[model samples]
Target: MTSIIQTQELSYEAAIKMCVAVTQHAHQLGVSVGVVVVTPAGVELASVRMNNAPLHALSIARKKAYTAASFKIPSFNWQERLKHKPDTMSALLREENFTYLGGGIPIIVEGKLFGSIGVSGATEAQDIECAEHAITEQLNSL
Candidate 1:
Protein backbone atom coordinates (compact mmCIF):
# COMPACT_ATOMS: atom_id res chain seq x y z
CA MET A 1 0.00 0.00 0.00
CA THR A 2 1.19 3.55 -0.75
CA SER A 3 0.44 4.48 2.81
CA ILE A 4 3.02 1.98 4.05
CA ILE A 5 6.61 2.83 3.42
CA GLN A 6 9.63 0.61 3.70
CA THR A 7 12.82 2.19 4.96
CA GLN A 8 16.36 0.89 5.06
CA GLU A 9 17.57 0.64 8.62
CA LEU A 10 21.09 1.87 9.37
CA SER A 11 23.18 -0.55 11.37
CA TYR A 12 24.73 0.42 14.69
CA GLU A 13 27.87 -1.43 13.70
CA ALA A 14 28.45 0.82 10.72
CA ALA A 15 27.87 3.89 12.83
CA ILE A 16 30.42 2.77 15.40
CA LYS A 17 32.93 2.04 12.66
CA MET A 18 32.37 5.47 11.22
CA CYS A 19 33.00 7.08 14.59
CA VAL A 20 36.25 5.20 15.02
CA ALA A 21 37.44 5.88 11.50
CA VAL A 22 36.69 9.58 11.77
CA THR A 23 38.50 9.76 15.09
CA GLN A 24 41.51 7.99 13.63
CA HIS A 25 41.64 10.34 10.70
CA ALA A 26 41.42 13.35 12.99
CA HIS A 27 44.32 12.01 15.07
CA GLN A 28 46.39 11.36 11.97
CA LEU A 29 45.81 14.95 11.00
CA GLY A 30 46.88 16.07 14.50
CA VAL A 31 43.43 17.49 15.07
CA SER A 32 41.28 16.55 17.98
CA VAL A 33 37.62 16.55 17.01
CA GLY A 34 34.18 15.33 17.76
CA VAL A 35 32.50 12.97 15.34
CA VAL A 36 28.96 11.65 15.12
CA VAL A 37 26.92 9.29 12.97
CA VAL A 38 23.19 9.53 12.74
CA THR A 39 20.27 7.91 10.96
CA PRO A 40 18.39 9.73 8.25
CA ALA A 41 15.73 10.47 10.82
CA GLY A 42 18.42 12.34 12.80
CA VAL A 43 18.73 9.81 15.57
CA GLU A 44 22.35 9.47 16.66
CA LEU A 45 23.89 6.02 16.54
CA ALA A 46 27.55 6.59 17.32
CA SER A 47 29.56 9.49 18.64
CA VAL A 48 33.21 10.16 19.52
CA ARG A 49 35.39 12.87 20.94
CA MET A 50 39.06 12.60 20.26
CA ASN A 51 41.62 13.50 22.93
CA ASN A 52 41.57 17.22 23.64
CA ALA A 53 38.52 17.84 21.54
CA PRO A 54 36.63 20.88 22.74
CA LEU A 55 33.66 20.24 25.00
CA HIS A 56 31.42 22.29 22.70
CA ALA A 57 32.37 20.23 19.70
CA LEU A 58 30.11 17.34 20.64
CA SER A 59 27.01 19.50 20.49
CA ILE A 60 28.11 21.14 17.26
CA ALA A 61 28.94 17.84 15.63
CA ARG A 62 25.57 16.36 16.54
CA LYS A 63 23.78 19.39 15.11
CA LYS A 64 25.78 19.15 11.95
CA ALA A 65 24.79 15.53 11.49
CA TYR A 66 21.17 16.35 12.17
CA THR A 67 21.20 19.16 9.60
CA ALA A 68 22.68 16.99 6.88
CA ALA A 69 20.42 14.00 7.50
CA SER A 70 17.31 16.09 7.88
CA PHE A 71 17.95 18.03 4.69
CA LYS A 72 19.86 15.40 2.65
CA ILE A 73 22.36 18.09 1.75
CA PRO A 74 25.85 18.92 2.94
CA SER A 75 25.48 21.34 5.83
CA PHE A 76 28.02 23.82 4.49
CA ASN A 77 26.05 24.25 1.29
CA TRP A 78 23.26 25.85 3.26
CA GLN A 79 25.27 29.04 3.57
CA GLU A 80 25.03 29.69 -0.14
CA ARG A 81 21.54 28.27 -0.55
CA LEU A 82 20.10 30.70 1.94
CA LYS A 83 22.30 33.60 1.00
CA HIS A 84 19.63 35.21 -1.07
CA LYS A 85 16.92 34.02 1.27
CA PRO A 86 17.77 35.86 4.44
CA ASP A 87 14.36 35.33 5.98
CA THR A 88 14.63 31.57 5.61
CA MET A 89 18.19 31.56 6.87
CA SER A 90 17.24 33.52 9.93
CA ALA A 91 14.40 31.18 10.68
CA LEU A 92 16.60 28.13 10.29
CA LEU A 93 19.31 29.46 12.59
CA ARG A 94 16.68 29.87 15.25
CA GLU A 95 16.13 26.14 15.26
CA GLU A 96 18.30 23.93 17.46
CA ASN A 97 20.59 21.32 15.86
CA PHE A 98 20.94 23.15 12.56
CA THR A 99 24.19 24.52 11.22
CA TYR A 100 25.71 25.75 7.97
CA LEU A 101 29.05 24.20 8.71
CA GLY A 102 31.51 22.45 6.41
CA GLY A 103 31.99 19.40 8.60
CA GLY A 104 28.58 17.90 7.92
CA ILE A 105 27.89 15.52 5.00
CA PRO A 106 25.21 13.10 3.87
CA ILE A 107 26.17 9.45 3.46
CA ILE A 108 24.96 7.79 0.26
CA VAL A 109 24.83 4.04 -0.03
CA GLU A 110 23.99 2.23 -3.26
CA GLY A 111 22.62 5.48 -4.68
CA LYS A 112 20.35 5.90 -1.68
CA LEU A 113 20.84 8.10 1.36
CA PHE A 114 22.05 6.05 4.29
CA GLY A 115 22.60 8.62 6.98
CA SER A 116 25.12 11.38 7.72
CA ILE A 117 28.43 12.20 9.47
CA GLY A 118 29.56 15.35 11.16
CA VAL A 119 32.90 16.41 12.65
CA SER A 120 33.93 19.44 14.63
CA GLY A 121 36.86 21.04 16.58
CA ALA A 122 39.31 21.49 13.72
CA THR A 123 39.32 23.81 10.79
CA GLU A 124 36.37 23.35 8.49
CA ALA A 125 38.62 21.88 5.81
CA GLN A 126 40.12 19.37 8.20
CA ASP A 127 36.73 18.44 9.59
CA ILE A 128 35.37 17.82 6.10
CA GLU A 129 38.42 15.80 5.13
CA CYS A 130 38.13 13.48 8.13
CA ALA A 131 34.45 12.86 7.54
CA GLU A 132 34.92 12.16 3.83
CA HIS A 133 37.90 9.88 4.37
CA ALA A 134 36.10 7.81 7.00
CA ILE A 135 33.00 7.45 4.85
CA THR A 136 35.03 6.54 1.82
CA GLU A 137 37.40 4.12 3.46
CA GLN A 138 35.06 2.68 6.06
CA LEU A 139 31.37 2.88 5.15
CA ASN A 140 31.72 2.71 1.36
CA SER A 141 33.56 -0.57 1.71
CA LEU A 142 30.62 -2.12 3.52
Candidate 2:
Protein backbone atom coordinates (compact mmCIF):
# COMPACT_ATOMS: atom_id res chain seq x y z
CA MET A 1 0.00 0.00 0.00
CA THR A 2 1.21 3.48 -0.84
CA SER A 3 1.51 5.99 1.94
CA ILE A 4 0.92 8.92 -0.37
CA ILE A 5 -1.32 9.72 -3.28
CA GLN A 6 -1.20 12.41 -5.90
CA THR A 7 -4.22 14.55 -6.58
CA GLN A 8 -5.14 17.61 -8.56
CA GLU A 9 -6.54 20.31 -6.34
CA LEU A 10 -8.96 23.05 -7.27
CA SER A 11 -7.54 26.51 -6.58
CA TYR A 12 -9.49 29.30 -4.94
CA GLU A 13 -8.73 31.54 -7.91
CA ALA A 14 -10.19 29.01 -10.29
CA ALA A 15 -13.19 28.49 -8.10
CA ILE A 16 -13.78 32.22 -7.97
CA LYS A 17 -13.60 32.39 -11.74
CA MET A 18 -16.21 29.67 -12.01
CA CYS A 19 -18.52 31.58 -9.67
CA VAL A 20 -18.07 34.69 -11.76
CA ALA A 21 -18.86 32.77 -14.89
CA VAL A 22 -21.99 31.41 -13.31
CA THR A 23 -23.01 34.89 -12.27
CA GLN A 24 -22.53 36.24 -15.80
CA HIS A 25 -24.62 33.45 -17.22
CA ALA A 26 -27.33 34.07 -14.66
CA HIS A 27 -27.35 37.70 -15.66
CA GLN A 28 -27.81 36.72 -19.25
CA LEU A 29 -30.82 34.66 -18.27
CA GLY A 30 -32.21 37.50 -16.19
CA VAL A 31 -32.11 35.48 -13.00
CA SER A 32 -30.30 35.45 -9.70
CA VAL A 33 -28.46 32.38 -8.45
CA GLY A 34 -26.18 30.84 -5.92
CA VAL A 35 -23.02 29.09 -7.01
CA VAL A 36 -20.59 26.91 -5.09
CA VAL A 37 -17.29 25.17 -5.77
CA VAL A 38 -16.05 22.29 -3.70
CA THR A 39 -13.14 19.91 -3.65
CA PRO A 40 -13.45 16.25 -4.51
CA ALA A 41 -13.66 15.57 -0.81
CA GLY A 42 -16.61 17.96 -0.61
CA VAL A 43 -14.72 20.80 1.02
CA GLU A 44 -16.05 24.15 0.00
CA LEU A 45 -13.60 26.53 -1.72
CA ALA A 46 -15.78 29.41 -2.77
CA SER A 47 -19.43 30.37 -2.99
CA VAL A 48 -21.62 33.23 -4.09
CA ARG A 49 -25.28 34.10 -3.76
CA MET A 50 -26.32 36.81 -6.12
CA ASN A 51 -28.45 39.72 -4.99
CA ASN A 52 -32.13 38.73 -4.86
CA ALA A 53 -31.30 35.02 -4.95
CA PRO A 54 -33.31 33.23 -2.33
CA LEU A 55 -31.54 32.57 0.97
CA HIS A 56 -32.34 28.92 0.47
CA ALA A 57 -30.32 28.91 -2.72
CA LEU A 58 -27.00 29.12 -0.88
CA SER A 59 -27.58 25.95 1.09
CA ILE A 60 -28.96 24.15 -1.94
CA ALA A 61 -25.97 25.17 -4.00
CA ARG A 62 -23.58 23.87 -1.38
CA LYS A 63 -25.36 20.55 -1.20
CA LYS A 64 -25.42 20.28 -4.96
CA ALA A 65 -21.64 20.67 -5.08
CA TYR A 66 -21.18 18.21 -2.27
CA THR A 67 -23.44 15.68 -3.97
CA ALA A 68 -21.57 15.92 -7.27
CA ALA A 69 -18.18 15.60 -5.65
CA SER A 70 -19.21 12.77 -3.37
CA PHE A 71 -20.75 10.70 -6.14
CA LYS A 72 -18.36 11.73 -8.92
CA ILE A 73 -21.39 12.41 -11.12
CA PRO A 74 -23.74 15.24 -11.94
CA SER A 75 -26.13 15.69 -9.01
CA PHE A 76 -29.08 15.58 -11.40
CA ASN A 77 -28.18 12.04 -12.43
CA TRP A 78 -29.41 10.85 -9.06
CA GLN A 79 -32.97 11.43 -10.18
CA GLU A 80 -32.92 8.67 -12.76
CA ARG A 81 -30.36 6.55 -10.97
CA LEU A 82 -32.42 6.29 -7.84
CA LYS A 83 -35.75 5.62 -9.53
CA HIS A 84 -35.35 1.85 -9.27
CA LYS A 85 -33.22 1.76 -6.14
CA PRO A 86 -35.60 2.64 -3.40
CA ASP A 87 -33.34 1.19 -0.76
CA THR A 88 -30.30 3.01 -2.04
CA MET A 89 -32.30 6.18 -2.48
CA SER A 90 -33.58 6.02 1.04
CA ALA A 91 -30.09 5.71 2.46
CA LEU A 92 -28.62 8.31 0.17
CA LEU A 93 -31.36 10.83 0.73
CA ARG A 94 -30.52 10.89 4.40
CA GLU A 95 -26.85 11.50 3.84
CA GLU A 96 -25.90 15.01 4.87
CA ASN A 97 -25.64 17.50 2.01
CA PHE A 98 -26.79 15.06 -0.63
CA THR A 99 -29.21 16.31 -3.25
CA TYR A 100 -30.79 15.17 -6.51
CA LEU A 101 -31.14 18.57 -8.07
CA GLY A 102 -30.13 19.30 -11.66
CA GLY A 103 -27.42 21.85 -11.16
CA GLY A 104 -24.24 20.13 -10.05
CA ILE A 105 -21.29 18.82 -12.05
CA PRO A 106 -17.88 17.50 -11.25
CA ILE A 107 -14.97 19.54 -12.42
CA ILE A 108 -12.98 17.16 -14.55
CA VAL A 109 -9.32 17.85 -14.98
CA GLU A 110 -7.49 15.68 -17.50
CA GLY A 111 -9.93 12.83 -16.92
CA LYS A 112 -9.74 13.26 -13.14
CA LEU A 113 -12.12 14.85 -10.67
CA PHE A 114 -10.51 18.06 -9.49
CA GLY A 115 -13.60 19.34 -7.74
CA SER A 116 -17.21 20.23 -8.43
CA ILE A 117 -19.48 23.17 -9.18
CA GLY A 118 -23.12 23.77 -8.32
CA VAL A 119 -25.66 26.43 -9.23
CA SER A 120 -29.12 27.11 -7.86
CA GLY A 121 -31.93 29.72 -7.52
CA ALA A 122 -33.26 29.38 -11.05
CA THR A 123 -35.19 26.56 -12.60
CA GLU A 124 -33.30 23.28 -12.56
CA ALA A 125 -32.75 23.47 -16.30
CA GLN A 126 -31.38 26.98 -16.10
CA ASP A 127 -29.13 26.10 -13.20
CA ILE A 128 -27.74 23.11 -15.08
CA GLU A 129 -27.19 25.19 -18.18
CA CYS A 130 -25.14 27.70 -16.23
CA ALA A 131 -22.99 25.06 -14.61
CA GLU A 132 -22.22 23.32 -17.89
CA HIS A 133 -21.54 26.54 -19.73
CA ALA A 134 -19.13 27.73 -17.04
CA ILE A 135 -17.12 24.53 -17.26
CA THR A 136 -16.91 24.65 -21.04
CA GLU A 137 -16.17 28.33 -21.41
CA GLN A 138 -14.22 29.33 -18.31
CA LEU A 139 -12.52 26.17 -17.08
CA ASN A 140 -10.69 25.35 -20.28
CA SER A 141 -7.40 26.54 -18.90
CA LEU A 142 -7.55 24.43 -15.78
- TM-scores of the models, in the order given: 0.94, 0.95
Which stretches in model 1 have alpha-carbon errors above 4 Å? none
lDDT of 1 by residue, 41-128 (tens): 8989999988799999889999999999988888999999999999999999999989998899999877787899999999999999
Model 2, total clashes: 0
Candidate 1 TM-score versus the reference: 0.94
lDDT of 2 by residue, 1-142 (tens): 9999987878989899999999999999999999999999999999999999999998999999999998899999999999999999999889889999999999987789999999999999999999998888766764
Candidate with top lDDT is: 2
Reference-based lDDT, residue 21, model 2? 92
Best by TM-score: 2
lDDT of each: 0.90, 0.93
